[model samples]
Target: MAGIGHITQDWEPVVIRKKAPNAAAKKDEKAVNAARRSGAEIETLKKSTAGTNKAASSSTSLNTRKLDEETENLSHDRVPTELKKAIMQARMDKKLTQSQLAQMINEKPQVIQEYESGKAIPNQQIITKLERTLGAKLRGKK
Candidate 1:
C-alpha cells in the first residue's frame, strides 16, 4: 500500500449572477401619465360648458279641494248619528263625564268624545265595552 501524503484532491467551480429589472414600476409610470392627460381634457370641457341653466317647468297644477271632496265621499263608514245621541244620553243619565266614562271602559277620553261627535270609526269591541258600562244596547238591531 501507498502512503496517505501522495493522494490527489478534486474541487467544484463557483458562479456569479445579476438581478432582473422590476416590471410593476414601468406599468405604474404609464398609468400616471395617462391620468394626467385625461385630467387636462376634463378641465377644458368643464370651462366650456359653464353657466348654461336648463330649468324644467311643468304646466299642470294639482286641485287639492277636489281631492279632499272625493276622499270624504268615499269614506262613508262612520258612527251613525243615532248611536252618538244614544251614547251622549246614556252618559248624561248616569251622571258621568266623558273622562269618567272613558275610565270605566279603560279607554282614552278622546275615544268617548269621538264617539259622541259621530267622528269615530265603529269598533265593535269599544261598542260592547260602552254597552256593558252604560247598561244599554248600543249596537245591532235596535
Candidate 2:
C-alpha cells in the first residue's frame, strides 16, 4: 500500500452578523412614535371633552327635567292592598304559614311576603295558582 497522503482542507470560520435596520424599519419607528404622540393628544382631547360635557350637562336641565317627567308618568302596577289583605286572610283561615302557602302555590316564600306587603307586580299565573290553592277569589270584580 502507498503511504497515505496528508489531506489539507481550508475551512472558513462561521460568523454570525446582526443586519442593520433598513429604511422600512426606520419608517416604521417614525410611524410608531407619531402614533404614540397622537394617541396621547387624543387622550387629552377625550378628557377635555368629558370635562366640557359635564359643564354642558350642568347648564342643560332639559335632560333632567325629561327624566323626572318620565319617572312621574311611569306608574308601577303593584299588588293591590285589598288583594293583599284577602291573601293574608285566606292564608290565615287555612291555617297555612307563608312558606306553606308559597309551597302549595309553587312559589318562593318571598313571593307570598311580597304579595302580603303589596310590593309584588301582579302576575296572572301566580294569581291563578294562589287562587287554585287557596280556593279564594283574589282577582276580578268581587
Top candidate, metric lDDT: 2
lDDT of each: 0.81, 0.84
- Writing each residue's lDDT as its tens digit, candidate 1 over 20-62 gives 4365643476755775777833222245434653222222224
Output the TM-score of candidate 1.
0.49
The TM-scores, one per candidate, come to: 0.49, 0.52
lDDT of 2 by residue, 1-142 (tens): 4688887899999999989657576457575587587783312224556535677676568878877778455667999888999999989999999999998877899999999999999998998998999998988685
Q: Any idea what lDDT model 2 has?
A: 0.84
Cα-based lDDT at residue 77, candidate 2: 98
> Which candidate should be chosen as best, given TM-score against the real structure?
2
Q: What is the clash count of model 1?
A: 0
Stretch of 10 with least lDDT, candidate 1: 53-62
